[model samples]
Target chain A: MSIERLFIANRGEIAVRIIRAAKELGITTIQAYSEGDADMLAVKLADESVCIGPAKATESYLNINGVVAAAIEKSADAVHPGYGFLSESPEFARAIEQAGIKFVGPSADTIERMGDKVAARQAAEAAGVPVVPGSKGRIESVDEAVEVAAKVGYPVMVKAAAGGGGKGIRIAENEDELRTLAPQAQQEAAAAFGDGGLYVERSVKSPRHIEVQIVGDGKKAVHFYERECSLQRRRQKVWEEAGADCLDDQTRENLCMAAVALAESVNYRGAGTLEYLYEESTNEFFFIEMNTRIQVEHPVTEMITGFDLVQEMIRVCGGESLSVSQDQVKKSGHAIEVRLNAEDPFMQFLPWPGKVERLKIPEGEGIRFDHFMYEGYQIPPFYDSLIGKLIVHGKDRTDAISKMATALESLEINGLKTTVPLHKALAKDPGVASGDFHTQWLEPWLEAGNLTPENT
Target chain B: MAQVLSPLPGTFYMKPSPEAALYKNPGDPVAVGDTIGLIEVMKTFIEVKAEFAGTFSAYLAVDGVPVTAGQALAELVV
Candidate 1:
């Protein structure tokens, strides 16, 4: 059934994006927010708004019951969970399903199955996809872990079975390190996800973080190419680009086909992403994990393909078939995106929340700024430091690099520190311009005191 | 003497809600695991539980103000 009223179970820029997409489809938008987000742009733009609870995420955004209540109370026919918060929560999706409300995402079963990293690994193996060889499933005891480690060899990664978004993972170079780090990783997983299940995987050295975007209708699915997400800091993406300048045509096609194969194997519905780690030395890629939600850097893919993915997800959820097939999807030019965070990059990326006294957004061809910030926008000190995204498109990687650097220079956000300076340095870096950086490249570079203005 | 530490960063709350009674007050008897206040961040509320049995002496953090991790929310005297 088509959505009549759509409730956005999230805040920030993604909320605004979903509202626009739903409104474009002639559906009324309902916004759910915390007390601190009452005055945010999403609440202001929605057809109706509700303050689910206080500013604390648990009482509001992360509270499945509260979000469901808001959707039901608003008479929303469907709920769109944006990224982060409870977006990946299978329990939340199940609650929405049990409430007899449509979720603009995969089924609760799909989320539950894919959310567990170990289960997803097993599923990938069943689908004939290449996964980093490790424990057969979640390892329970230290002896079991050691046994698996002996088989998998050293330099293994201990991961939270249910973890994603780049946290709750640790790498051990030797058996001793694994024995010492496994329990610590388990405790962290227990505290973060309330699940202490741990698994081991062979660690790929300096791998390129490549992710393929997939959309499907349960029985079939298509790929939207892939994004080069290797340039990261703290295992969190700082820069993203559509298509890897490093991959050959054959390799690119194979990677996208591999992603589509996995999605089709699961009979996946809605939009999902399969992340892979490509070993540069071997030119072989192994499945990392899948993110069962829309991503922050989706703009780069959108730019390259000219597809409004948020709209696509909404329409597909409303029983519409994907407008295009795998053959119909086309990519053009190159696109790059950088996160503009309200943080002091020089000071260990410390959050610098404050009101923007002045803002000068760059405006030019191939430049897109995705943000909800305006001058005097009081970035509440209580949430993620990401304030906006700067996405740029060009004929090729080099053009995109220059255009992004120009865009960063033109963007002048005053009254608070930001990672704009860092982005500028990254854009001008010879390695980044040549697309030579890897997943673990940016952090040590930052610690090496490479963020100075002259460094650019 | 003892202190109640905020487990996470957020605005401190003395009571469960404005209409609800305060969790603890000065001169109130408290036990280990007693919730002296609430600390909320990222839309999550975590209880600031007492570590040792004591008489609650004072609220170190102002009510409804931002408190960071390990910030003392309250003081206690044995």
Candidate 2:
């Protein structure tokens, strides 16, 4: 059931990514855009374009009714949410299905179940995936949280049952802080998500954030190995690479198998990621949460596995089964991805959205700039600040790092500040060059005044 | 005539909610920090506060229209 026309219900780099994938499948593309983004790269590249609403994401991208109406009016057979905005929203998926259009993602029920961090944790544990030890279930009150904290030891993380993107999170070091923070966290969760339920989990100190990429055909699943997303600033990823060199072969296989097992347990369909917090000191990894969409760092995995994940997702949604078996999946070379955001890292990473007066994208073999920026294109102050993703591949990690360093040095943009300066500093930093940094390393390094122009 | 321009890129709203009445209208008097409208973006609705006090003139942009930063939102007669 290959769709005749695919409606892209997102914007920016992901929109461009989906359009390229759909065009390869001979499917006509209809790109949905806000008034401010009518001239976006995807809109210009798609077979057709539709103005969904005003510039605001809520009125355009996040408006389920608006998106569904566009799909129906344009006779689009399938809708691709890409990532972010409404990609993980169960209600949005249901709206698309109710309109008799394919959602190009998992079923609504699956999205809902996996969306709740607590429920996803329960699901992973039930599937025999190793999870960090903490409260047996949702804690009822501060007393219960204190009791759980006592058993789990100090330094427990209080998380909202329905949280995402690191919201409703608190780290309590001892009984006093737990008693003080549990109720405060509950109130905040109640205000934010309308769910006062809370859970406690043991915090992995200086953990390296890694995730396994899995794609399923609604029956079976296969993993494309893992990506190390440990270089983070303010708990957000800046640098990512596939097939990390830290883990032993045994550990890597075990981790990947655990991810696939979780995918099977959920009967997941389409592309998803199983995130983990790996503590290299103890050689142990704990399941954190599952992202129910193609992630931003997916290109690194694609470079290693030689699979077009977006295309694979579309094919699976079109009723095509898994085309390759586990044995057929191969990992080769090394790949690294750096997120280039239009923000001033020196000004606390504040958004610096404006026009790109000059743009000179890097060019070389194994260098890919998955971006949507062009000369004179206005970078709206609304929406995500990510201007592009710079991905590079090489024969080995050192080769990849050297290539990436060179690529970062050669990259140029004007009229707006970006994280390029910070990345340039990071590429030459000894810790990052040697891959010795942990998830919490970047912030302290920045706090040490390492990102100043003079520092670089 | 001084124009109250939108300070950011978003949808300009005359009402707090669709069913709510317009926050201000032509011929209405306004003051500094008075919320003349709301600009919606990224799911956050920020109040388009008046930076100058004056007699409220007609709105330059239609309600619910997308407006770029520095684009005139409403006209003010000082």
- TM-scores of all candidate predictions against the true structure: 0.80, 0.83
Provide a comma-separated list of chain B TM-scores, one per candidate.
Answer: 0.93, 0.94
Expressed as tens digits, the lDDT of each residue in A1-456 for candidate 2 is 778899999999999999999999899999999987878899999999999998767788889889899999999999998999999999999998888899888989999999998799899999889889987777768898888888877789999987776767999989999888888899988889999889998878789998999999888899999999998876779999998888899999999999999999988889999999998877889999999998899999999999999999999887789887899999999999999998788877766777899998899999999999889998876687898999999999999988998998889898888989887888788888788978888888888888878744
For candidate 2, list the clashing residue pairs, or say none.
Answer: none
* Chain A: TM-score in each model: 0.87, 0.89
Interface RMSD of the predictions, in order shown?
Answer: 4.4, 3.2
For residue A227, model 1's alpha carbon misses the true position, in angstroms, by: 0.5
The lDDT values for all models are 0.86, 0.89
lDDT of 1 by residue, A1-456 (tens): 677889999888889888888888889999999987878888889999998998777788899988998888988899999899988899999999999998888999999999897789888878877888788778777778788989977788899988885557999989899889888888888888898888897888888999999998777899999999988887779999998888889888988998888888888878999999898776778898998889999999999999999988887887888888888899999999999888788766766766788999999888998887778787776778788899999999999999998888889899888999888898888888767778888888888888896865
Whole-model lDDT for model 2 versus the true structure?
A: 0.89
The DockQ-based CAPRI class assigned to model 2 is acceptable
